[model samples]
Target: MDTLTTTKPLATYVVRHADDNLVLGQRLSEYISWAPELEEDLAIANLALDHIGVAHHLYDYAAEVEDDGRDADGFAFLRDERQFTNVQLVERPNTDFAHIMARQFFVDAYQVPLWDALARSADERLAGIAAKAAKEARYHLRHSRMWVLRLGDGTEESHRRMQAAIDELWRFTGELFEADDLTDELAAAGIGVDPATLEAPWRRTVLATLAEATLDEPHETVMRTGGRRGLHTEALGHLLAEMQFLQRAYPGLEW
Candidate 1:
């Protein structure tokens, strides 16, 4: 790792963070009218909005770093699938309530620590964004943790579904901590936090939550990769097709 002498790593780092938030936010939005309960629908919508808000701020900063004329909307709606660097976890489909909760739980666990560390970044703009995002991440973590408990310890069917969700999604979790040249450079420069550093604390929190929920932790298995390298699962293609449709069909269309 070395100090970042160029803005490339910084912009890429910010873009990766933005991609994670935006993709997960979009997935959460799919539950707007489909949540099991009306109150739950509102809650999920608000959470999705929080994530999108974080993405907007990060994208705005990234645009400035790249010295590009593109704005937040451009980054959000114009990028092709191969340009996104979000982890494979967030791009997965929300198969069910249990699956959604499991995904959120894993992500928020990582995000809380990530944002906390980023709040101390040498880059002031990034620090500010992380400070605000850290607050939202805390709330998101709490919400998802409660759901994991409720579903994991509830009725037999609920318990089964929660376990299944955990098992299915566990493989994707490892990619959250994978480091690359961009992260390595930024982290050494104190402009970004090394994601690998967050793993131990994340595991502690997640394991405790699972224990309280009476859920068995899934065994470590073959891990998924390549999202950071601009490769993605099939789900992301479908997601981008729907999400970028309006913008792609009518470029720069404004309300």
Candidate 2:
């Protein structure tokens, strides 16, 4: 198996994970004042903060590995769209409450297992970050899972919306488990977990949740990909434009 046994690939791998959390966190933050209820708004804000905090640590570690003079903020706010390696799933727009819940459910299911396995990594810092992140991922999963169940089983309109969200988001999920040379090499060196290993567990949890909610499992479809390779949907570019605007407008300004 090809491996990412070099410094660059390792840094890239770490940064990709950071990018995933950062982008998704930003998306979730958009719901802070827009959530269905005041309590829900606070809940979503806290969840977004959780992801952003994890991203900060991961990006810091990646910067240290890369030794590129850039810091966590640079990686998070200054990079161009092509520089991001997060899977396309996290970058898609949150169209509605149902769409947001479905996206969170899919991502949290994958993240729970990914972080759990990474918590045992041979690299000490990576392991430490994973250990912390695994805890947050568990909470994220629980929150998202409950919302999925509520939306999927609640009212006729909610059920229809939840199913639509599931169908629309399902295609992007394949990238979560798609292994590439970077992962193969990192896994071989005990620096990273092969994402493919998390797939079975993710499916089981997602399927069980859907079943209990009375939601149908979406039929397998041709998966849209490329974010792992620095290619992404137009949506990501727009997301970045907004996210990076502050930094771009004021190159080195600080509060």
Candidate 3:
């Protein structure tokens, strides 16, 4: 676990977003050489770099916000799963190709609007970071959106699998817009985008894509919670173990 815990609103907000990018970046990197096609492998690798690159920028900004002398490496490598503030959606495992694309599409859909909103933020640094991330997110959404259309409208088997992936992952979507007290305060101050306000647009984007892909909107189900507060599925622990192994094994080791 990290030694310094911060409660400053901007740093908290920045760390949460940084965690989102970093966790999703790590998850995408798992497909490094494993994508189904050569072109896709390269594309996914680039997308992973884009996400990790944003994470590095966000973490650096977070360290600046906290002003506790900890840097980007400290936040990215020193924190435990319980200290991570990412949404659970990003932490989900790559169960299969259908599941992978489904998950990516969902997050990409949310993040596109999110970064777009933040690009107009009161905090200039965050807005700068969001401006860059917004471009990458648009491309990420396009890539995932194309795959979703192909898989969902392709064959009976592909459609069935894609639908199944959507259904299973639906339970985790609610948390995307669940804003906490701190988040609400930050939103009011214009330092953060209130996730609650993004839901309507996100719904429009997602539902339209689902419709085009001939996929059904999932029925409302019990949604998972607590990722922002550090409660997580067992999956994050295993992931953190692997992700943090090098830094943990050799403290202060640098490339």
Candidate 4:
């Protein structure tokens, strides 16, 4: 089946995941140099690598239908913030280790379900990619869950920090479950998962994990958005400036 004529279902899923991972990966990369500890530096770098690896697989699929001849690297390093289609949460700053762990806990937990749903997509290519990414996401979730438990159940300060992080990040969590036109069309065609359907299960998983970690759920409230449509925060502009510096300065230069 020609995906282009079929509303480009699989391609949208791959590209969405890829764009989210790439943007988040770029944000995490910034911490490599600023992390308070060397172990943390390595861990952030590893996480960034994992996200970029998943992105490579996703973007490769997207490139097949891309009008331009650009490949994954080109798609990754070349795009400006306005061109990105990631969720707003990914671009949020890592305020502290506890906050970082909290955010990762939410994202990684959500990633597991997202990939698992895609693994059963009507699109075979997307299912194959999701199968591969699901394995990686599983581990990522475990790592994040462990940190959440430790921080949440640790000393008074650690517990307070973990709870505060969760409160600060809750607003962003709503966007993960928010779907758009592309998702609606794809879900109807059975080529994509409805992010809305995953909300209850996702919330259950999060609540369970947080309970195990001794974390409390804050009252649900207004959620922030805009990354899905390429509108990002001021911080994203700074991030893009750094990530796209070499690309913008020397356009068409690639090793």
Top candidate when judged by lDDT against the true structure: 1
Query: How displaced is residue 214 in candidate 2, in Å?
Result: 0.5
Per-candidate alpha-carbon RMSD to the true structure: 3.1, 2.8, 1.5, 3.6
How many residue pairs collide in each prediction?
Answer: 0, 2, 0, 0
What is the per-residue lDDT of model 4 for residues 36-153, given as tens digits with 9 covering 90 to 100?
5788788889999999888898899888866457788777777766777788788878788887778777888888888899999888888898888889888888888888898889
Q: Model 3, 100-161: lDDT tens per residue? A: 89999999999999999999999999999999899989999999999999999999999999
Error of 2 at 40 (Å): 0.7
TM-score of 4: 0.91
Candidates by lDDT, descending order: 1, 2, 3, 4
Residues 1-255 of candidate 1: C-alpha lDDT, one tens digit per residue: 222212477888898999999999999998799999999999999999999999999999988988868788888898888888899999999899999999999999999999999999999999999999999999999999999999999999999999999999999999999988888899999999888999998999899999999999898799999888788999999999999999999998998
State the C-alpha lDDT per candidate: 0.92, 0.91, 0.90, 0.81
TM-score of 3: 0.97
Model 1 deviation from the true structure expressed as Cα RMSD, one decimal place: 3.1
Tell me model 2's lDDT, rounded to 2 decimals: 0.91
Q: Which residue pairs clash in candidate 2?
A: 3-185, 4-185
**In candidate 1, where is summed lDDT lowest over 10 consecutive residues?**
1-10
